[model samples]
Target: MIRITKSIISIFLLLSCFTTVVRAADFKPLPQWMKTAVFYQIYPQSFKDTNGDGIGDIQGIIEKLDYVKWLGCNVIWLNPCFESAFQDAGYDVINFYKVAHRYGTNDDLKRLFDEAHKRKMKVCLDLVAGHTSIESSWFKASQKNEKNAYSDRYIWTNDSTIKPEKFVSGKFERNGTYMKNFFDCQPALNYGYGQPDPKCPWEEPVTAEGPQSTRKELMNIMDYWMEMGCDGFRVDMAGSLVKKDPDLKETTNLWAEIRTHFQDKFPEGILLAEWGKPQQAIKVGFMMDFIIHLRNSGYDTMFFNKTGTYRRDTCYFDIKGNGSPDFFIKNLTTQLCAAGNDGYICIPTANHDFQRPCCGERNTVPQLKTVMTFLMNLPGIPLVYYGDEIGMRFIDGLPNKEGSQLTKGNRAGSRTPMQWDSSDNAGFSSGNNSSLYLPIDPSASRPTVEQEKKDPSSLLLFTKELIALRGKYAALGNRGEIKFLQSKDNQYPLIYERRLGKEAFIIVINPSGKDVSVSLDYDRVVQKVFPVLNSSKHKIIDYKNKQLKISAEPLSYGIFQIY
Candidate 1:
């Protein structure tokens, strides 16, 4: 009987072990789409190029799949890879089905999609449905005749009237025959078309008004891409879809309809909207993100000194335009509770189409990492930009005295080149040196993926480790109830605590010349503490007499687990 009982007990233990491993892999922390998703945005041309075309291609991305997976990112949000006339990145889509010959062929795209899925990572293509290249087949056909079947696919008004001086829409303008353009060279679509082109069903409006037209057009689009096995979309200018001529309410409704259709079809797919307005976007079930600058309130901001960090306000209750540390703590707590169901506040350090933070502005890695920790671990969802893992190279003023290429301080500046190795062209392309579109950064201190892999504390490794840590705790990611610890810190350091039910965390940041002492007595909720990652300038000293004291190197952050 004893031997039989022992065998049964051993079998039960085996089953328990198997279940634990499976649970970790099948961690469905968030709702259908977001659980276990770490999205990495790619600026294609700057990511890599092959065949000496001086432009990035689909094949270039395939070569770097291992590097992407190594970063622990399981979701890829690629910037536009469609055919275009090279204006405003690739927001202007020329062909929806075919891969741009310049980028590669259909076979290359198929291969890329296949490889991406094989690595257990999902791929989301940029869908610029709002407008198309004026050179697109449908647009060309529509422009041929005023009453063409494809004429009403876009928001076009052919009054031949010159635009008003300093009018409402300030995107861009061409001649007196100006069509509404988010940028120059992009003509707005006409409101309602009688029929759609044979190739494009979205060429014509379904009804006279835009609401019904948008519904039909967006549904058709969702059907095509989902059928092609796309995971979802990082929709471009989603807020601009409804057009301001009729006000944003109509546009916001269009988004709600668009979001619902995709959500119903690809229930487990991701949808990250680039809408700047969070209040309106969440209504339609979308995640809104920042451009380059992260919404921040550093303790250093309060100091009237060399450091530029903002000092937090005295009261933590108000969520207005107050950029205070206490304000951050309190408001973040409110966001944790409310923002998830309403809309997700995606805080990112920088993206491809924006100014690089490192251009001429000197801030240590610790200072940068501290900010990263604060943003990524906050209650709401965290969106990481492409090169933000490592300090990226930056160029200043479009017209510089150094004769280097001048970026518009918009998308062009950050869309330079990927520093993979210290190679001649940063391993971006194999073409001849002069054939390159953008010049390689010349600094020797440029951080490369190869070099960063060897260093555990490298910005790349640190980001990866931190991201993985977030995955470990379901409470840390998405949004939940958060509470900031009580403290009277007069510019000593930005210290606070975060709580989600029984789960609680402490955040401390030191962006100054001297180290400061951290005390648990500031809050009555002190218990045992365990340290997460901190910048090189900081260390976790022993908890002595209810006080944690250490010499924090400037621009440092500390994340602690309290039990």
Candidate 2:
């Protein structure tokens, strides 16, 4: 009897261990579609104006669906098209259930989803989950003198006169001050606090009825859209939901619960967080998080760092090539190590909030080609910001539109209308130039799709080739294993290998104006080397013993298959 009981106990232990592993994997499994997704981020108001109103709309995007597919992006991350006051662009969401009038009606969005699906692509809407426009019905209801269901939906102090940091008072019948997430016109929706302070009696726990209801409403909003053919959501300010969560423990738990429900209902649905910390965001429920310019992740050291904005004037992708890859590599390595297989780290050429790679000094075709190579070959989802494929210049000195100017800098420059052709208003809109959403690039030589499609060496063609190459190679994709082949002596010519099973490819990028050679001490013996893609005119590659020698020209890049 003792021996039988021991055997049964051992069996139970093993079963329990197996269950734990299975559950853990189930909780945070990366969706299959996200594995190979190449995203095109469109700022809706700037993409294309089909209505002649100078504002881009759903029908306009629907018209450009083929153009996006032709560019090789399978997924479209559309900025918020929901009903909004447009104080902070479209981010100040007013009604979660309705589409913005400027963009189009609900049926137009449905048609967009259908059209995209017809072309074998998916669309992800930007979800402004953290806050709502001050004009939203929920906020209006919450501000009443009498208590209502939404009274506690937002964080409010007990006394109207008491305004804390990031809190606003006045112009309300309510006896308390409300919290603001970003702009003054936006009021934060409460998801509760991590540790409710005793001094702040208004602070509620996550389990409070108000917080619980808010979570349910958020889920409802997601469900409403998913039921309407939406594939997923790119949540804006995903990490800021739970207040005062130092380590984001409670916030993480909140997302974990939401993800559980989200996956159960729509297993294919993905959540892309705007949060810069991929390590923590992926640990929670997000399938992807952006490594943007906001977190000081040294991403700026590569492409976007303005002269005095960062530690160095020269970025890794600059024409002068005075920058070091060490800073960028270190931060990327840390994020990749921490994130592991849980999710992917999304890297963008430049989002709507920052300067494009074609800005300032790094605007040449060779320089842009090197940037595209590095971005496309990396082990993450490459987000091609609208107008970036053709090297659209970020027009400086543009007046702020819809609160595009912030404390850091004015983002109006990057939010200009897309330059489709050299025609009137760059083919963005037929309206008067002054009445357009933003001014078109005034430069006579500004690159455009109409012109680039006819040129073999245009940045647009290079970007397209890079995307196609990434699609053709499983090793060059997100799930592939990346091994940086950097030695102290070869830092300038950044080298890395992407491998999947038996296939492997080495990428070399030299972002400098001078020629460079690097001898990499790799363990594998190179039986043969085929240049898959080469930006350099010379085919300078040799292998001796276990060492591999590669020579690259100024502002050059190459992808080689190894046998």
Candidate 3:
């Protein structure tokens, strides 16, 4: 009887373990399409104008769909196109349901969705959930003295006499002042605080009636777009909701609930967060998140540091720069472990909020090529900001347009109009130059896609080759495992191996102005040396004694397929 009981107990334990493993594995299956997707982020104001309105619109995006497809990106992350006052550059949304007049009607955007789908591509629109413009009907209704359904839609103090810091007052006839998420024109939506203060009766908890209703409305807004063929949303300031929560637990729970409902209805729908903390965001059920320029998540060390003016002393991308990859590698490893196999960590070349790869000191074609090599081969999803492929320079010292002025210098330079050719307004618009969204790069050497397309050895062509290489190798795709190989020397050349099941590939990059070599215990035979642009100087020195010696020229990179 004792022996029989022991056997049954062991069997029950095994079954319990098996169930736990299965449940954990099924936490959230990442969308298969996202595993190998290359994202292109389009700043609608500067991408391309079709109707000579000087501002890029949905029809313009449709016109440039072929151009995006040619660049090898399978997904598009378009910036905010909702009706807005253009304060904070469309981040201040005025209406949740209406399309901005400057962009086009709702039908035009839907047509873009249809056209993108025909080309086998996906589109994710920017969803700003934390705040709304002062012109928003919700905000306007909340501002009225009389009580209404929208009165509690925004964060407001109870007493009309007290004005909070970083909040707007006097404009609203309501009893209390409202908080601002970003610019003064943008008011924070009341998602409710994690811990409500007893003294402040107006500080509602997450479980309050108003907060619950707000969550429902947010979900409804998402449903409306998902039904229109939108693939998903790249949530703006995703972590900013659920105020007064230092730990972000309440915010995470809020997103998790939303994600659960969203996935149930649209299983393939992707949710990407702007939150820099991947560890927190991934756990909250986000499919992916970016290491944006908002904070120093080791991204600034590899690219241009915006804290200072253009200088060769700062960025790792520049040949003469003194920047190091140690910081980036350290932060990335932590984020990768936190994300595990559940979500992706996106590394962007340059977003609308930061300087491009060819900006500042890293303005040379060879330097740009080396940077592109690193970007395309990284283990995460690669995001190419609209004009970055052709090496667009950030025009410095332009007047602020659409609330480009922020605490971190004016972003007007990075928000300049896209350069298509040398035509009037750089082919961005036929409208008057004064009416253009932002001034074009005035340099005589401004790089244009039309001119670069004719040149076989241009940066544009090189970017295309890198994209092709990434697609050709399964090991270089988003789901592949990456291991950083130790370099014989300190910093010049960085080596890493990418493995996907049975197949493995090695990538070596030298982002310096001098030649560098590394020795590795790679005894396998080199099947192929994938051609890298401007890397003709790279060569395999020796592969004997169970050790391989490889050298790369200044600003060059190489990929070796091993067998």
Candidate 4:
């Protein structure tokens, strides 16, 4: 008997050793403290105003850190605090090391980072390595002469006769005559800076191929920010990094190099790529972006990819005479969930460049709550848009223009300021309220944070609750497998099952109006139900007698436990 007991103990020790090695070799995730923690995204200009400069600054973020923490988020993903011309809301970065004077100094960022760490939250910086601002000194230097070292740092194409075949798809008029820019003035890096524009003669063509020196330069840019005490990088335009180029091996390899370099210093630096190609991108030791897959998969049946989606206020239908409501959100939500199945995702509802989701009431409180639950609860990292929590709407009253600003897309309404209070200027700053960076979201007062906190049903309060709930489950934020569950009703309601070892989560959401009833099949396991959401608490949310009946409210969701 004693010999048998010793044999069991020996096996246990062997298993423990194997498990420890596996854990260490694998990505040791950010502390579980961030698992159920929510992230509050802040657009420096809109979150709060420290000085009366009519702009939000780092001091303002520092001041509001407590409020953000109180909102139940341990991870904070700031849009872009780096110095920029404010074109595309600082996405067009000019300097990686320096914080823009408009936002604050390097000290302010240091202070903010310190404060966030004290709160036990993880912070990720938005890395815009995709493209630097055209006005950036690098571009300036490269454009100055065709012989400068900086000239080869950016992608500039010469050979005015050859056009990137993809560039001629109605978006740009190219008979190999005019050089097209992504945002007109913003020249797409020719991969090599000194190279003349492939369609023009002003600059020499430089292929994105760096041989070796250019990789060193990009490494320097990445190292600069990580050394500034950043926790991770959210690689921008990840898929676009190797675009229309026959040799994408060089670009993807560059990402692998960046991953290897930073992972050494910050072992868990959260290397998340915005690259949507999961098969290739995920294997490269970085997380993937997942929107294209969602729409195609039809997380919900009402929408047919982005094709079925259109604005509710002014939706035009095909001859079918019907429109899908916020079908795009299904794309976004399932995108996060699917990616979570593989790697991490930099999930944000609306960023600077795109039109805001809440423009002209794309979201109601119930709808917003459902979306928040979907966003935070889905696997991957949740990136909150600057003002999405309070249901900040956009205002596109301005006429479309032909210049640098977000003139065409529904961008004006999305970048609106945070509705801090019900006071004039939404308490963003003491500066002249009329001189806001972007116009105040029109329907803000009814759904403001102050009002939401008081009413449990408000969107702001719902956001706080969702973030808090996410903290309770480790699988929600990490490597959990997603099994898309089918709803009994084939209407707008879509359901999916998630299995993370012993923890199983059922997410049921309806992105459109019109109630639907469905039954869920949890054939295998008996469950232990825990409270993850506030709105709906159905005591027995598990399968009984081999069946689970679910009644979903219009434009709402219920998170369930199937232990």
Candidate 5:
């Protein structure tokens, strides 16, 4: 028994070493442009209007390319401009090849691409790979009782008698019911499940002819967009492509195949996954994956958590909040270690699916600045939502517009029209107020880019400064190595070090409502201190004894460069 135990231990150690070596060798370099690229997510419907149509169009985005450039974002991620049925917004894609008429024509989108390229900026469109609208031509052909070329494009059970759970049935003349990915308007495409049950003849394997054809069609769609000068796609629900993928090995393999082919044709083109599991997504050749709000992946605890409410959550960046950094740090560290040099873990301020940073109780400039500091200085690509820089509040209790219905919360609050100015409809539209996409913020004190751009102390200017700082310092970019130096003690402050080769910088944040002092080991001479909003309130009281005493006021942050 003792001999067996020793042998098992030896095998375990050998496997551990082998795994580490394999992971190190398997690292795939991300696209050259992504290393320093800052992404700005644009919700086109609410961005701007050019024709007084009350809806933002492709021309609107084209006209505002300068504004996006001024915001310091090199990459623009447009949320689903594809032709859709608008049931789940653009997620219910009806035509993959055409741009939505509400936005513009195919030529208009192409012009937007050319305009963006002229500014030396890249664009990534949202690709919904897992599903399509029930109204799509493919689905129309699929619903027919007669067999056809596109019959196997979507998932269907054996017969109408055998109804599958969580699926829609009886609406089509086809013998079987089709599976739904999200809303009933969207039907899941048949990529084939990883595991096929013998009893279920409809459960196709990944290698089957039908699934292989689906994969080819998806590639064709990607190829069509790539030829149009689009940089790449921010794939939606990337992990859900292959149903019943228990370990996600099949899904990973599927993406791996696509990556292998995609890289050959478009070397500069990159793929960003919305998959929250970066560990698996990176392994499967995705250049980057988002650490989204789904599954409480520490993102919720950091900024979205609301304190003293029925929700009973704490937001770490809130001034009067009691949120902890332990949860966020642990998850972030694990993901970073796993990612290594393979890909980035994008940290977004907020997305269309969630509330903005300046929402609810955390609407102060100090809170916004501190949060932006943390996002900009972190070791990943920083994604800023459209209106977040101007401190747009997530307007609550707005009725659902463009399928923003979800049980978690009203996403309409976050999808409100971008406040461009203080003019009628906040300058987002010229059409009648009743025809606007979503009503502009009704609050008299609603923030606007025009108002904030004039104020030196506004969140917009502060955000611009932070973006400029990130661009100026290599140690603060996504490629930098991060180390959490002092975050265990909640009373002290949140501190971390970012190192890029020989360059190093220390970042400190005091989110509490009280003054806090922390000791740091900084024997070397301190370089210039970047002036944040409240830098005057932070100071180094003592520099002797090889230990530096740093004091920060409530809801303040500072970045210290080290020689």
Candidate 6:
């Protein structure tokens, strides 16, 4: 018995070593453009209105391409513009082949890709792969009483009476009940279950014909767009495809297949997953994934903790300075180690689903600038949501539109129309207030692009300056190596070194309302001070005895080059 146990241990050790070696060797180089790519996320319905119909459209996006380029973003992550029922925003896709009529035609979308590429920029469309609108033609054919090609396109129970969890029945004519992904309007596609139970005869294996057909259709849809100049996709709910995928083994394999297909056809096309788990997402073949507002991912702990998500109001960037970077740092290191050079972890200022950096207590320019400094200096790709660059406030109590109200919170606040200028509808549209898609910020002091563009010290200009600084130095870009140089006890006045070859820069941040100082080891450096971003006063107090002392004022940050 002892001998058998010893043999088992040996086998386990061998397998662990083999797994490590496989992971180390499996990483493929990311696209050349992705290394320095900065993404600008645009919610199409809120960006701009070309014909003054009150809803932002593809032509509007086309007209604003120059503005996007001017903002120093080389990639545009456009939210779903597909045909939809306007339920759950544009997430409940009705047709993958057509753009929503309210937005424009497919030709207009094609033109958007053309225009973006002409400006040396790329556009990534939002791909909602997990589910489709109940109004979709595929779902319509699937719900028919007779068996047809699309009869099994979506998941359905064996009998109408056998209603499983999250199942919807009695509305469709089909004899079997169907499963929903989120809302009643969105039905889950048949990607098949990772673990099919023998007792549940309705559960289909991943190798089933229905799932294979669905995979083929997904490939066809992607090919259709890529053939027409579309760059890539930001796959929504990427990990939510296969059912019962607790380990995500089957789901990863599914994406691996898709990755293989894309590599052969459109080698330069990228795939950014909304998986949130960077470790698993990178292994699943996504070029990038988000460190989003998941339970323990530490995103909320760093920025806005309005709902007490993770650690509550004690955000790392809060003026209170009550939050610690330990949680965020741990998660970040784990993901970075897993990713290595394979993929990037995108950290956005704010997305459509959450409050921007300028919301709530972090409304002041000094506070916003500190947050921007930390985010922009980080090692991975930086994503700036539409109005976040201009410090747009997240308005509360707005009426829900297109299913913006959810269990998480009312997303309508973040989905408000962009405040471009002081014109009618804030230059978003020429339509009357009643005809507008959503109400504009009623605050007279609400920041606008026009007003901020004229102010050199405005947050909008600061954001642009930060992006340009990032572009100016290789050590500040996405793939640069970063080393934290702060002392162990105090996490305030966060200090870090970004070095690539001979190019090195030290960045310091003090988010609290009170001043803070930190001592760092600088044995190998000569001090020649040049401030790249000094939002508030930052000074090198002393450089004596091989220890460099630096102090920053309240809510201030600075980037210094070491000579």
lDDT for 72 in candidate 5 is: 95
Q: Which stretches of candidate 6 lie over 4 Å from their true place?
A: 1-28, 307-311, 428-437, 441-443, 522-524, 537-541
Candidate 4, lDDT over the whole model: 0.57
- Candidate 5, residue 38: Cα displacement in angstroms equals 0.6
516 Cα displacement, candidate 4 (Å) = 2.6
| Cα-based lDDT for every prediction | 0.57, 0.85, 0.80, 0.57, 0.81, 0.84
Better of 2 and 5 by TM-score: 2
The better candidate by lDDT, 1 or 2, is: 2
Question: Where is model 3 more than 4 Å wrong at Cα?
Answer: 1-28, 305-313, 432-436, 441-443, 487-489, 520-534, 538-541
- Looking at model 5, the pairs that clash are none
C-alpha TM-score for every candidate: 0.76, 0.93, 0.91, 0.75, 0.92, 0.94
Error of 5 at 96 (Å): 0.2
Report the C-alpha displacement of residue 104, candidate 5, in angstroms: 0.4
Better of 1 and 2 by TM-score: 2
In the range 75-122, model 3's lDDT, one tens digit per residue, is 999999999998788999998888899899999989999999999999
Question: What is the Cα-based lDDT of residue 378 in candidate 5?
Answer: 92
Superior candidate under lDDT, 1 versus 5: 5
Runs of candidate 2 with Cα error greater than 4 angstroms are: 1-24, 307-312, 432-436, 441-443
- Candidate 4 regions exceeding 4 Å error are 1-37, 157-181, 190-211, 288-342, 355-363, 398-408, 428-436, 441-444, 475-477, 487-489, 520-522, 525-544
5 versus 6: better lDDT goes to: 6
Name the top lDDT candidate: 2
Per-residue lDDT of candidate 1, residues 423-501 (tens digit): 7556554565323335554555677777788987777887887787777776576543455543645444566656667
Q: Write the per-residue lDDT of candidate 4 for residues 14-102, one digit (tens) a residue.
A: 99656533433364343433334345666667777767777778888877777777877667777778888765667777887789898
